[model samples]
Structures are given as C-alpha cells and as structure tokens.
Target: MQSQILPSRAALVDRIALQFEYGQNLIVLLGTSGLGKSYLLETFITDKYNDFNKAFVQVGAQMTDVQLMTQLLEQSFNAPLIDHNLSLSQNYYQLAKQQQCGACLWVIDGGRHLSEELIAELELLSKSAPNVLYIMIASQSKLPFKEVVNIHLEPLNLVESKQLMGWYFT
Candidate 1:
C-alpha cells in the first residue's frame, strides 16, 4: 500500500484521515483530472475504514439526474429494478433514509458531470439524512451542494511526488 501512495496526496490523506477519525461526516475532495484524487479516495476507504455501507457513483457527462439517482439507488441497495414510473431522485431519497440506520458512506466520483439540479437533490438527501457521509470528487471547487467540507488537493510537492512514484511504482 505504501507503493500506492503519491506525494501530492499524502498530506491531504493525512488531513482526511484526521477528520474522519474525528467523526467529520461530509468531505468533498477537489482536484483536477489525472491528479489521483479517485485513487486516493479508494485507498482511504479501502485501507482506513470498515463497517460503512459504501456506495460508489461514477458520473457521466450524458447522465441525467434521474439516471444518476437510479444508479446510486441500485448500488446502495444491490437491487435491480426497471421502474420508469418512479423518479430516480425520489427513490434515492427513500433509499438514503432506509440506509441511515447504520453508518452509510457514499462516494460520488466525477461529480462535475452532474447537473445543478441533481447536485441539489444529492445535497438535500445528504443533509436530510442523519447518518450519511457524502464524499464527492470534482475538478473544481464549485459544488451545488451545501454544508460540505471541501478539501482541495493540489499537485504534489517534489518530495511527495517522489514518494508517490516510489509507493505506486515500487
């Protein structure tokens, strides 16, 4: 796992770990493309945490809010359904409520692709739910959601970059 660490991400990961350890519920990791934000997120969740019901959503440029919600619901519930009548936002909200009995962590990657409306819907869902931790990755800092803790991931420093190369390539 050390090999997987990148210099640009070590300090951010340390900060995130500290926040998580302190029970900070929502964190938004902001970075540009190809900066290893997603990789760092994966490493954090896989290596540092357990007992969290995890849902990972990959946002596509062509995806609709409904489609995104449907995908999120499917991942969270491990269910397959073909209900065109039910709006995806409604379904997602309901599912979040149901999942809130336990600790639930949702990782939304490429969130910049989501429409403002869908982002707002997600924000509402997270805000209304008591035990939901939403971690979003985006290229920039602007998010349609509110009350989110933003962590900006800048490019790695020289030492950190070398460390990351060593961790991932060794």
Candidate 2:
C-alpha cells in the first residue's frame, strides 16, 4: 500500500511541519487505540524523511530505560552503544553533534508502555537535541514533559472511510 495520508488530513501534517520548523522539538500523537494514529505518524515520516534523518522504534512493555536508550542510539545514529558514564541528555547532545547527518526525526511508537523514567529521559533528550524532532505515539497524554506539542487524531470520516474500503475492495 502507498504510504500516503488523506488530503483531508493535510492540515494536521502542515501544522506538524510548521511547528517542527519553528523549533517545537517534542511532539506527542494522542488518540484512542485503533484510531489510525500509527498510520498517520508513519505517513508523515515517509513524506518528510527526505528532509531529515529518520528512525523509529516500537517500545515494548518490558523494555528498560537502558534498552530504550540503546535502541534509540542505534536506530538514530547507527551507533552500537551509548556511553554509560554520560547521561541520556548528554548522549543525545553528543550524538547530535558528532553525527554529520542533518536534522533527525525519532518516532517512538507504543509509548504508552514506557516507564516514567524512560519518558523523562526522552524529555531530557529533546532539550539536548533541539533540532531533532521526537514524536511519541500514545493512547493518552501521559508524557512527563509539559512543553510537548500534542496532536490528537480523529477517526476517519464517512467519505474517507468509504474511500479506504474502496481501495481495499477494488
């Protein structure tokens, strides 16, 4: 299937792009389960990847803070491991500074399962890498950080619903 979001959703995409361009680093995608939240975020990333280095990781319920940071570092910077002595915020800053790659977009899907400590680390990472856009997909607004840019996705309307069905049936 084509990784395209509906034109009706263009406003949301535009808003995200505008805010990210204007220095909004942490973006939270909130919606009820099965509301196409992941689809929307994926389409946005696919559409915008040409402009930024992109990485994505789906967090599991049992993942530890160190594992989360390791995954992020590997996915975003292709690094094997983060320096244990450095704080998460420091690692993020060091990675951003060392990587010659342009701005990065890090998508953490299934964020609802992350522990409070991991989320807090994410907040610190955002501050350290101002140019890196961190988007978290969660079922609710439970992020520890208050300065996040929240995007609430609504379910598809009738017209869009019919179109999606047609795409599958035709």
Candidate 3:
C-alpha cells in the first residue's frame, strides 16, 4: 500500500504505515477485543489507500472458503461466484490476473476465525499476485508466519480511555 505521512492518527497507525513503507505483502494486526483492531485497519485504509479495487471481508464463525471468495469476488472484482464449475482458487486467481484488473487490497476483520482452506488460499494468492496486499485484523498474539508482518495494538488504560473521551467531546 502506497502512503504519505499526514495529520495525526495515533502512533499505532504510524507504525503500520512504516511497515507498509517497507513493502511487505501481508500485514496482520493483532489485538484483543475492544482494542479497536477494526478501527485501526479501517483508519489505515482510509488515510492511505485511494484505490478502487479493495475487498473488505468480516470473517464470520461459520464462514466457508467459498463464502470467503464469494465476498472477495463481489467486492473487489464485481464478479459473483455463481458458477459451480470452477473452484474458488481458480476463480480468484483468474480475476486477479486479468489485464483490466488494477492493484487490489484485502482487509479482513476477525481473521483468526478463518478456516485452514481460506488461509492456504490466501498464502497462495500472496505468492502468485504481485499487485495485491492483504491486511488481516486478528486477536491472536502469535506471529506464526515468518512472511507476515505483525503489528500488536495494546489496550488503552483507564486514564488513556478518559483522555480519548476528552478528545472526542472537546
């Protein structure tokens, strides 16, 4: 993701921006619930990216691999997965490599809930597609993948929360 330093948006966002500046393909935002993982991801995307090809998927508990790709197809490519003829892997890869397709970004919330199939496919996509970037907001603290740049967001303390509220109401 291309970026430029701008207005104040917390140190966390700035850190992630630096990671993007390093040209990493996959970045995982790790934080517990209520730590605003989703907020950070959305804010980062909003502040930095201006591209039209971006996929935003919220991973549900029961989501299947097909469901995952279906959302990606719908959001980024505007190509719904109606045909049962092709596998999810083939469909996304074909669309992603299309001559008309621009650089794509995938922002997945609750990424820890993703199934193994989804994870495997994502790794494959990252390897094959040079124009795609993925940001996964997960609550786990582990950095299992050596290729994934992990950014951990700490929860706000009580006083910090009060300070934030003050900033909000001012």
What tens digits encode model 3's per-residue C-alpha lDDT throughout 1-170?
A: 32322223367677776776576667788877877777766765575567647778888789877777788777777555444466656777676656455767778887877766666667666666645555455546554454677777776777777776776587
Q: List where candidate 1 sits over 4 angstroms from the true fold.
A: 1-3, 17-24, 78-89, 96-101, 167-170
Off by over 4 Å in 3: 1-9, 80-88, 141-146, 157-159, 167-170
| lDDT by residue for model 1 (1-170), tens | 43456544666677876875565656777777777778876776576556766677777788777777666666656454535566654665555555543565677788778777766666666656555555445545567567767887777678877765775587
* Inter-residue clash pairs, candidate 1: 3-167, 3-168, 4-167, 6-164, 7-160, 8-156
Winner on lDDT between 2 and 3 is 2
Best candidate per lDDT, number?
2
Residue 55 error for model 3, in Å? 1.3
Winner by TM-score: 2
Which run of 10 residues does model 2 get worst, by summed lDDT? 132-141
Q: Put the candidates in lDDT order, highest first.
A: 2, 3, 1
The TM-score, computed over Cα atoms with residue i paired to residue i, of candidate 2 is 0.84
Q: Rate the local accuracy (lDDT) of all candidates.
A: 0.65, 0.71, 0.67
Q: Number of clashing pairs, model 2?
A: 0
Residue-level lDDT tens digits of model 2 in 10-69: 677788778777877778888888777677677666776576777777777787777777
